[model samples]
Target: MDDRHSRQSWLEAGLSQLAARGADGLSIVAVARELGVTKGSFYWHFRDLKDYRGALLQQWEAQYTQLAIERMEADGGSALDKLRRMLSLPAAGAERLGLALRSWALSDKEVARTLKRVDARRTAYLAGLYTQLGLDAARARTLAQFTYHALNGRFLLGDMVPAAAQLDLLLTLLTAPNDEAVAETAV
Candidate 1:
């Protein structure tokens, strides 16, 4: 096999390593081995491990977060439609990568900062979609938080994820207008 891997290949192998063994799997040696090359090959692609990790995070954000949002925006659907399409993304794989990144964040400040930015961006995007659905600013932000957290939590739940019927009900609650009010009897 050819040993001279491109920078993209290094990033891709790093992602695979991250997914397979969490943050601990992201060392230069491990990624080099994954690419069937020596650790020295990593220097040709990255200045150091910090640089490599930064590039990996950048690649992750560009591909998984930015591209998905771009496509959904281009699709031009209703808020609920776009939300459903976007929400389906977490369920379509990449859970391991996300979990690994989060795990890495626990012990690394840079990773934590990057993860925080990514999460906030994703949550803001969800809030934007919810706002488009006619929710007030506060309500939209709150529901977006719930929906975003729940989507991530669903992965952590493994087989404990709610049934389709249960999820449909939650979806309705999320998408429906919250204008219903109880009649005041004492006032």
Candidate 2:
């Protein structure tokens, strides 16, 4: 591999390691050994552990964030359908990227901060979508929070909730407007 590919390979390898073993077991020496390269190779791509972590965050944002937003914004469906897909993302991935990221955030301050920011962006984007759907600000905010927590909870539940049933519940609740109060219609 060339320089760029080599660097990405190590970063990806690092994330995979973190996923399987958590950050406590991640070490430059270990990643170097896995790649069959010297520790020096890790330096060529990353300045230090922090740099590698930053790269991992960047990789995550690049690889997953937009795809998720796009999935949530898919055409011709009730917002509930979009919401259900967002909730089901973690279970759908064999690698459990969502769980991995959540695990990383538990031990890494920077990762935690970035996760919060990414979540805020997602929530805001979803709130805007809700607003466009005719929800009031408070209702939109509540829906956004509900959707965010629902998805996170869904990831944690995994096998406990049958995938199909969990998705069905989310679609039913999230797609429908908050309450059937007078003077307001569900989007």
Candidate 3:
């Protein structure tokens, strides 16, 4: 492979290993073996293991966060609809990503911190979006935070709890209204 493609292949191998095992198990030799290359080739692409990790974190965060931000911004719909879609994405892609990162976070502080920062930014943006949709500012922010935790938890527990069913329960809880809405609808 060419230099650029070789580097990308190394990265892909590292990430695949990360997903299968955890970040703690990631190693230059392992990556090299996976890619059918010598460990020396890994050095040609990255300065060191840390450099490889930094690059991986940057790419994962930027790509995932940008896609999420774009989805939040592009759709012209009820905030609830947007929220539902956002919450629903886990079964598709985000959940798998979150699960892998969460496992990494348990052992790697740098990865954990980076993931936390990215997650906070996304949550804050969602909170702002929620506030625009007739929800009280505090309630909106709380719900936004809850959504992140819920997604993380649900996906982590996916082997035991069905994703669709868990998402439905979460959606119902988040969208349920206050006493006034209840009384007002009581004809």
Candidate 4:
């Protein structure tokens, strides 16, 4: 009787479990039970709980960050269009998983470091997009920081997300004729 699931299945189930119940749901036995399999099945898929967790972190970064950036870059659109699409991605179900990771980061140093690095990578990408729209490097980076912070804050604050038109206006300010004009208008 082959009760063993594939490694990908194991990793995916772990992510779902984490998203559903935070890091407490990450135990090997818990995930095995959720999958209707025995704890031995987890051992077959990963070396141990630590190995499983490392795999999960890698999978999360790849699926949520790297692949997302790749898909956005592949699209034929202006920087503003890509920014709009990027902001809208949480609607596609990455939010809960991402929030779960953020929650987990609060308690785990390793996760905190990974989250920071991932965020910097994302912010740098945003800065590049803003720069493409003709903003100076310093201004572009500042806008990226605000955009990144607002996006994450919205993820946490739920009902506080700005409407589509507001987001469009914000993106438009990045391309305004004067640096001080964009800065003053934002405030």
TM-score for candidate 4? 0.86
Query: Which residue pairs in model 4 clash with each other?
Result: none
| Number of clashing pairs per prediction, in order | 0, 0, 0, 0
Worst 10 residues of 3 by lDDT: 178-187
Q: Estimate each model's TM-score.
A: 0.85, 0.75, 0.76, 0.86
Worst 10 residues of 4 by lDDT: 86-95
In model 2, where is the ten-residue run with the lowest total lDDT? 178-187
Q: For model 1, where is the 10-residue window of minimal lDDT?
A: 178-187
For model 3, the local distance difference test gives: 0.74
Q: What are the per-residue Cα lDDT tens digits for candidate 2 across 56-106?
A: 888877666666677556654765556545555555542466677778788
Per-model RMSD to reference: 4.1, 4.3, 3.8, 2.7
Candidate 3 ranges with C-alpha deviation above 4 Å: 1-4, 92-100, 159-178, 182-187
lDDT of 4 by residue, 51-79 (tens): 88889999888887898799899985998
Computed on alpha carbons, the lDDT of every model, listed in order, comes to: 0.79, 0.70, 0.74, 0.82
Is 3 or 4 the stronger prediction by TM-score? 4
How much is 125 displaced in model 1, in angstroms? 0.6
TM-score of 3: 0.76
What would the per-residue lDDT of candidate 1 be over residues 49-154, giving only the tens digit for each residue? Answer: 8898889989988877888789889999898888766555545557778888998889999889988888888899999988988888898899888988888887
Who is ahead in TM-score, 2 or 3? 3
Runs with alpha carbons beyond 4 Å of true place in candidate 2: 2-5, 71-81, 90-107, 159-169, 181-187
